[model samples]
Target: MSILLVEDEAPKRKNIRSLLEQMDLLGLVSEACSVGSAIRSLRSSSFDLILLDMSLPTFDIVAGESGGRAQGFGGVEVLRYMDRFKLPTAVIVVTAYPAFSQGDKEIDLTELGKNLEAQHPKIFRGIVFYNSMFSTWRDELKTKIEEVIIR
Candidate 1:
């Protein structure tokens, strides 16, 4: 199966790739370091799964842009694009912040998840935190990926 990995930080991406390799789920992996590149990758190829980082740089290096500021909702933009196009690829959202931890009442992940699901059901396979104080994220990620494979 094909997988698209979208992450901005080099070290984090490397770590995730290592984890996937350990899980024996690292097949045909492709990387996108920014929102623009992720979207372009989506347009160019079909993937069975996408490991998406919520925060990413604004510009796409593959498109000749060197660097750009981080876009806070870069992953959301990619999701919206997939939902708009009705892409069949399953997405697993990875983030450092807790989904409901945002103080903003209207902008928190709870609201975002609800709104997105209302529009495009079954688009998200899971939302996993890369770091958590009370949960084992790595274990959860492995479980979720296994479930995806079964599906």
Candidate 2:
């Protein structure tokens, strides 16, 4: 039961991987850098939980940070993409999208959870937030991943 980690930053990815290993979860941590890689990973293997980075470099992170993309995507784009799957793999969109309250049409965490649970059932576990500057989220993700793995 691997925990798929889809993040682009080397430092953050390393730090998160370290924490997961510390929790006796090294074998359960898999990494990916982009949407294509992530999708491929999902297709080729099975993961208990997906620790995603909502701010993918796909839409030009530079442009997204500077406010340019039409979709205003960061991590939520992953969620929107998940919704399209007829046999969608279970997913959790780990992101830092701003102004994405529960009411917004955009891909919010609460909505994403509901969608995954409702649409994908057991395969779609849940989500965990990512904090680039801190390892707290990494530890928290380890706990969440453990729950799914143990189940």
Candidate 3:
């Protein structure tokens, strides 16, 4: 199955890739580090699954330049784009943050997941909180992937 991984942090991306490799499910895996790059990939290719991070830079980071402003709900934007285009790809948010700002208030991951599912039910599969210190996220991700595969 084709998979698109959208994450800005190098270490996290590496870890996720390693996990996918371990699962032996790394078929046609594409990586994108920013909102723009992720969107471009979505436009050009079709993916069975997308492992997304909640926050991302506006564009890909250059060697000497900082990537543009970071979007707190970047994964949401990507989901919206997929919904707009009626893409059949499913998304599982792999976020490091437990909560993020939404306007003036903070929204927890659970609430964000519910909102996303409500807004884009067709493509929003679920959310997986990632913490490098714990192995739970790895198991959770594996379960989610297995579910997708069975579907």
Best by lDDT: 3
Better of 1 and 2 by lDDT: 1
Per-prediction CA RMSD (Å): 3.3, 4.9, 0.9
lDDT of each: 0.79, 0.63, 0.91
1 versus 3: better lDDT goes to: 3
Per-residue lDDT tens digits of candidate 2, residues 1-151? Answer: 5678888777777877787778787786787776656667767876666777756655333433632333333445555555555434445555554335344456666776676567556456666667776766766676676666566
Stronger candidate by TM-score (2 vs 3):
3
**What residue pairs clash in candidate 3, if any at all?**
none
Q: Give the top-scoring candidate (TM-score).
A: 3
Q: What is the lDDT of candidate 1?
A: 0.79
Count of clashes, each model = 0, 3, 0
Off by over 4 Å in 2: 59-90, 98-108, 115-120, 133-135
Model 1 vs truth, CA RMSD: 3.3
Q: Tens-digit lDDT track for model 1 on 5-42?
A: 99988767887888889877677799998888899999
